[model samples]
Target: MSWTTPSDVVALLRKRWDAGAYLGRPWEPVAVPLRGPRPGELADRFGEAQDWVRRWEQVDLVRLERVRTGGRVIGTNEIPRRVWIDTFEGLCALLRVGPAARRFEHLLELTGRRFPALTGWVTAHPMKTLEAADDWERLLAVVRWIETCPPGLYLRQVDVPGVDTKFVERHRGILTELLELRVDPVDGVPRTDFAGRFRFRRKPDYVRFRMLDGSRIGGFGELTVRAEEFLAPPARRIFVLENEVTYLALPETPGAAAILGGGYGVGVLERMDWPAEVELVYWGDIDTHGFAILDRFRRRFPHVRSVLMDQDTLLAHRVHWMTEPKPTRQPLGALTAEESALYRDLISDVYGPAVRLEQERVRFSAVRRALGP
Candidate 1:
C-alpha cells in the first residue's frame, strides 16, 4: 500500500538511531513524518486505509496525530497525519534495543566526566559507541592513557590494567580517532602508523632486498631486513620489482638490490630514510595500478626511475597481454611524460581490450637486458 505501514514508521525512526541520533541530545518530543494516504487515496482504499490507521494507533512506539477531514463518500473522518516518537525510552522500546541505549548513556556520562573533550566524539558516533559496547570502556581507557601520560612512550609501555599491545593494535582505527583528540602534533606520531603516532615501539617494516653482490652486502643472498637495519648499511642502485619471482631471479649487478612487496600498500616505506638516498629503479607491470604505484613512488622520490614499463615493452609482449579487471583512470600527477602516455593508452582501451603486460610475463632476457651490466 502507498500508506505508511507500522513497520515503515518504525523503520523511519530506526534510521535516526542508525545515524547516531540517540547520542546527540537529551530526549525531546520527536516525530516520524507519517506519509499516509492523501484524502483522494483514502477514498480509493477506504476500508484498507482505515485498518492501516488502526494499526498505527494500536502500536505503542508511535502516537498518531489526526486531522478532521470532510470527504464526499465518508461525511467526516479523522485521518492519521503525523507520527510522534514521544521519548528516547520509547524510541529504545520501539527499536527493541533498550539495553544498547542504556549502554550509550553510560558511555556518554563517563566520557563527559573523564575526557570532557571526547563528549563531542561520543555525540558524533553513538551508533559506533553502541556497536562497540563491550569494548567501549577499554577504548576510553586507551584514550585516557595517552592523554594522561607523556606522549612519547611506546605503545608497549602503555600500562592499562587489562588491555595489551595487541588490543591497542586491534583497535588502532578507532584509537586513532580517540587519541587524536587527546594528543597534539608536538608528539612525533603519524596517523598512518598507529604505533608511531602514539610513541609505541612498533614492529619494524621489513625491506626484502636481494643483494646483487651477496658477498659485499654481508647477509643472505635474499634478505628481508627491517627498514632501520636496511638504512644502517650504505645501499646504492636498488631495483624494486613488483613481481616476486622476478625480484628473486634478477641477475647480480655489482651494486644493486632487488626489492618486492605484496599489493600496493607501500605506506611502510614512509617510515624509512634510506630509499630517499639510494638510486631507486622500479619495474612494474604495464598497467594502471603499476603506473599508479610508480606515480606514488615518484612523489616520495622524484629521482626514482621506472624501467621495463614502457610502450615498447608492452608492444613486444602483445601475445602475453592480459585484461586488467579493474583499471584506475585517475590522472596520475607524478608520472613522467612517457610513463603517463603509456598509462593513458593502457586505461583508454587503445591497445586491445583492458590490455596489460605483467612484469612476471615479461621475458627473462628482456629483464636481464633492462638491468644492463
Candidate 2:
C-alpha cells in the first residue's frame, strides 16, 4: 500500500483538536471538538490516508508528553529561554495564530526555521535605538533619497519638511560627517596680523598669511591668505586673483596689493573690514566659477569691480580656453546689471559650459594691460 500524505491527516487532526487550553493546566490533553466534520469525511477526501492520520495522532501525543515532562520540543536552544513556548497552544500564541490548532504545525515549523534569520537581519539593520527613533528614521530617509536620486542631484534639491535652512546650516558639520559630503564654510576676510603668521599645524596644505600687516611673510610657493589680511589696517587697495600663480607673480602695485581668492572663498570675504578709500578689484577666469567668485566678492564689497573678466577678453583668448566641469548658476548676489547679464549668458552655456579663460592662461602683457600703468 502506498504511504498516505501527512497533510490530510494533519487537516483531520486540526479539525478534531480543542483550540483552548485547560485553565491552570495548559499542558494537559483536552478532548477534540466533535461538532466539526468527522474523521470519515477526511478519510473520504484524502485517498488511502489511514496511516497518515494515525501518525499525526501519535506525534500529537508525543508532543503533549514532552510538554508535560517539561522537555525542550520547540524553537532553538540559542533563543532566549524566557520566550520559548512549549505546548502547541503556547506556540500558536507566540506565532499569533489560533491556540492548539494542529493543522498549522507545518506553518509553525516553517516559522521556527526562518525566524532566526529574520531576527538577525533586523538586528543588523536596526531602525531604532535607545536614544531616539528620529535619528534612525532620518538615516533611513537619507538612504532612500540616495537610492532614488542620481548622484549629486540631491545636493542641489533642498526640500526637507520642517527642516529650516538655519537648522541645516547649524548642523552642516554633523550632516557632512554623517553623509560624507563637503560644504563650504561661511567666508570672511582674515585678520592681517593673524593671516600673516597663521599656519595650520595639522594641515600642511593650508597656510595663513597676514594680508593686512606687512611684518611677517612665509610660504614661498602657492599660498592661501585670509581675507582679514586684505581688509585689516594698512588697508591698501585690494587686487583679488583666482590663480595662485598670478597672485604670486603680481608686480608691486605701489600702494595696491594682491590676494589669492581661493574659488568659493567668498565665505572668507564677508568677514573682513574694508578701508573707506580702498578699492577692491577681482580678477578671475572668464569661466562660470570665476564670474561666480567675482559676483560673491562684489556682494560682500559692493564697490568691488571685475578685472580681465569680459567677453572681449574671453574671445581674444579663445584658443586657450579650457573646460570647466561644473559651471555657475549666474552671478550670485549683488552683481551690477551688466555683470549680472554677462554672468547669466556665461552660466547658461551660451558660450558652452566648458569655456573657461583661466587667469594663468592670459598673457602677462594682458594682465598688465588690465591692471593699467
Report every candidate's CA lDDT. 0.79, 0.49
- Writing each residue's lDDT as its tens digit, candidate 2 over 275-347 gives 3257877888777777777776776677887877777787788889888888756437676676667677777
Runs of candidate 2 with Cα error greater than 4 angstroms are 1-125, 128-235, 275-277, 330-333
Off by over 4 Å in 1: 22-24, 32-57, 60-64, 71-74, 83-87, 110-117, 150-157, 185-192, 206-238, 254-281, 295-306, 332-340
Tens digit of per-residue lDDT, candidate 1, span 115-228: 789889888888877777788888888788777787456778888888988888788788888878877633555677886666656665687766776645554566677766
User: What TM-score do all the candidates reach, one by one?
Assistant: 0.75, 0.44
The global Cα lDDT (0 to 1) of model 2 is: 0.49
Worst 10-residue lDDT window for candidate 2 reads 75-84
Steric clash count of candidate 2: 17
